[model samples]
Target: MRAGGTSELKQPSEEVQQLLETVKTELEEKMERKLDKFLLVSYKTQVVAGTNYFAKIDIGGEELVHLRVYKNLQGEVSLHSHQHPKTREEDIQYF
Candidate 1:
């Protein structure tokens, strides 16, 4: 994807899973609860000083979350932000 442009939403790759795992603890802490499910629905990526990933995760049933995670040029991953209680019908975009 071009710098500053967001990529089309696509299936989560091994890289994306690893990124999520890197911040799983932080995520759970921010979420105020442990995740019972981690179904990745799709994700969009943007090129910046680092790369940004906007992901839609199915926590369970109709409940979902939108996550914005960043991977720096040095390849360190961090959770940037998140939106919770999303539905499957909601379009996953930059939040």
Candidate 2:
């Protein structure tokens, strides 16, 4: 489509592909926590004006922690932490 007759082909190199594979594997391993009691808040949707995400994790039988992830106006992902402690009088809510 250019003035020159030759055309340029774009293909990912093997080394680049291998590096991407390695990074993917590392992310998977880190996301898969071995500990029994832990919460993971992953921003599923891309950072936008009004992106919403929800996550729930139960430490013990009664300990429940629910998190809501959202994107601020600046397009930054913000995690809102909500904790329901067994003995605490009031639930904790913090960013």
Candidate 3:
């Protein structure tokens, strides 16, 4: 599926895809908001010695706010978000 006006959606392994979907559903329900798009970024790090999966979300095509669902080594998952800086002088924060 296409997402966020970005490149075509990257296909993940079956296990990873299932995990991603679970995370997405939980986030949508817990936050009580619908995600308009999903962008997946996956890669392996030699130094870190594990795979990383991230689901970047876009809502309403504004690009002003976004959420990231991250799965790291040890099968730990976490959710974080970022928002565009309100002012040019302000720094962007990822959390």
Candidate 4:
């Protein structure tokens, strides 16, 4: 990856999974819908003062979303943004 470019998609790491789990409720609230049976398909990352996680989420059925979750240097995690109704063919990118 370049100085400020995003990394390629990788399987969610243990740390990534924990970060998502830590912010699940916040994410659902932001989307204004429950995320039941959601799968963490893949993710890309951009490192800055904090790390931006662009993740492809499979929320069952045809409902998919790409979430930009940020984890700061302080280890705080939050849902930054999201693109909904994404397809399996869509590549995860910065939002």
* Runs of candidate 2 exceeding 4 Å displacement: 1-36, 40-48, 72-75, 86-95
lDDT of 4 by residue, 1-86 (tens): 98999997898677677677676787788888888856788899999999998988788898878888889999888888888889
| lDDT for residue 84 in candidate 2, whole number 0-100 | 37
- Report how far off residue 35 is in candidate 2 (Å): 9.9
**How much is the lDDT of residue 7 in candidate 2?**
24
Instruction: State candidate 4's TM-score.
Output: 0.89
Q: Ten-residue segment with the worst summed lDDT in candidate 2?
A: 1-10
**What lDDT score is found at residue 47 in candidate 4?**
97
The TM-score of candidate 1 is 0.89
The TM-score between candidate 3 and the true structure equals 0.37
lDDT of 2 by residue, 25-61 (tens): 3333444533245433221222235543333334444
What's each prediction's TM-score? 0.89, 0.31, 0.37, 0.89
Ranking by lDDT: 1, 4, 3, 2
RMSD of 2: 17.1
lDDT of 3 by residue, 62-91 (tens): 442333445567777665433332332232
